[model samples]
Target: MARGKEYGYLLDGLNSERAEMIKRALRAIPEIKSISIRPSQGTIQLIATKDPETQVKIACEVAGCVFRLKLGRGQLA
Candidate 1:
């Protein structure tokens, strides 16, 4: 996918509480530069210095949920 392109994923079965927990966990990763919630897809987009694989691993470990990461440059960045 092109940089800055919006990616989508299904975060089904996760309620607001769980989503917040996941967001907290993801934010805990120092390498994660930033994060934004894509409510439409129920997915969280993370802007990180670390690679997608590493970010996903940390997210899974902390949130106890499977996550997929897509790399894209932010238009404003």
Candidate 2:
């Protein structure tokens, strides 16, 4: 299996303040491989070995906003 997977999330309610909260929430989850947040554009990029849906879900939940999937790239062999 691939060691990592990358996904992008477009969140509705993400700002500088809530971005920190989401960061903390993602950090607490071991399944998350990495996270990059763009507070200006309200975009979150994540690398995770687990389910992408779950990762996006948690991010939206923690940010208290609706999530729209912006991008998903499959692992290259």
Candidate 3:
């Protein structure tokens, strides 16, 4: 069976540059399966195999950004 989980995050106070940095940071971790970002809404939607909260926290720290847990439409899968 597939054991993957999805998570959505809403990043505040981020521009294109900051979003890029965060993407790189998250991609560096193997646990992060996929990453999607919306610059207009500052939303980062991710698919992770495990421990998404920790992974996102570290990525945000590395990127010097802050985020909140906000699930968008159809993001709970």
Candidate 4:
């Protein structure tokens, strides 16, 4: 392991109003080792024990927000 593999997301429709809910949803998952969200940049950074896309998708749904993923190449890691 190289410390941790950072997985990132370019949020399609994130705004201040929905940030808290999404952050809260992310926090519910224990495998996520790190989290950083920049509402202004419309991006989210995460490091987890495993791939987090599925959990992220679920969180977005639970928060009732629509999103589009960035490069099919995957997140920032």
Candidate 5:
């Protein structure tokens, strides 16, 4: 892995298909190795192993208004 940073996004009110679309969009980034999603406190937590900024950009592009990312845990590796 490149080993700079990992990205985490909190997605709310999204169905499985939508989540998969997000995942696919994320995978389009060549640096991203893997992605994991789990339900947390009424939101879906998306953890992706890649550059943090790149992940956030991808999330914003793909999700648009359907989800918002938590700023706290945004940087992880």
Candidate 6:
């Protein structure tokens, strides 16, 4: 998919079920190449094209979560 930027976030009240739902929602977004969740670490990592913040926010909303901390941005390996 020629993935572009990598994004990471700490979403409040994260759990395995919520993370699973969030991942499902994010998959529907074409810009997102992939999604990773570190439940033990409370991290959500995304490899996406263009700007995914807004869509990420929406996906989180659908999962009943709000971003608590932005883990920052980076390039996908």
Model 4 Cα lDDT, one tens digit per residue, 1-77: 44565777777678876777888888888788888877787777887877788888887787766666743444453
Q: Residue 48 in model 1: shift from native, Å?
A: 0.3
- For residues 1-77, what per-residue lDDT tens digits would candidate 6 score against the true structure? 56587788778778899899988888888888978987777788888887677877887788887777677545222
Tally clashes: model 4. 0
Q: What lDDT is obtained when candidate 2 is compared to the true structure?
A: 0.75
Over 4 Å off in model 1, which ranges?
1-10, 52-77
TM-score of each: 0.54, 0.75, 0.76, 0.78, 0.55, 0.82
The collision pairs in model 1 are none
Error of 6 at 17 (Å): 0.5
Better of 4 and 6 by lDDT: 6
Candidates 2 and 6, the one with greater TM-score: 6
Tell me the lDDT of candidate 5. Answer: 0.54
- TM-score ranking from best to worst? 6, 4, 3, 2, 5, 1
Native-vs-model 6 lDDT?
0.79
Show where candidate 5 strays beyond 4 Å.
Answer: 39-65, 71-77
lDDT of 5 by residue, 7-74 (tens): 55556655666666666776676666666654333243334444455564566457652446554553
Model 4 poorest 10 in a row by lDDT: 68-77
Candidates in order have lDDT scores of 0.55, 0.75, 0.76, 0.75, 0.54, 0.79
Task: Using TM-score, give the best candidate's number.
Answer: 6
Lowest-scoring 10 consecutive residues by lDDT in candidate 1?
1-10
Q: Rank the candidates by lDDT, best first.
A: 6, 3, 4, 2, 1, 5
Higher-lDDT candidate of 1 and 6: 6
Scored by lDDT, model 3 comes in at 0.76
Residue-level lDDT tens digits of model 2 in 1-77 = 55777777777877888888888878877777888888788788877887666756776786787776666454211
The number of clashing residue pairs in each candidate reads 0, 0, 0, 0, 0, 0
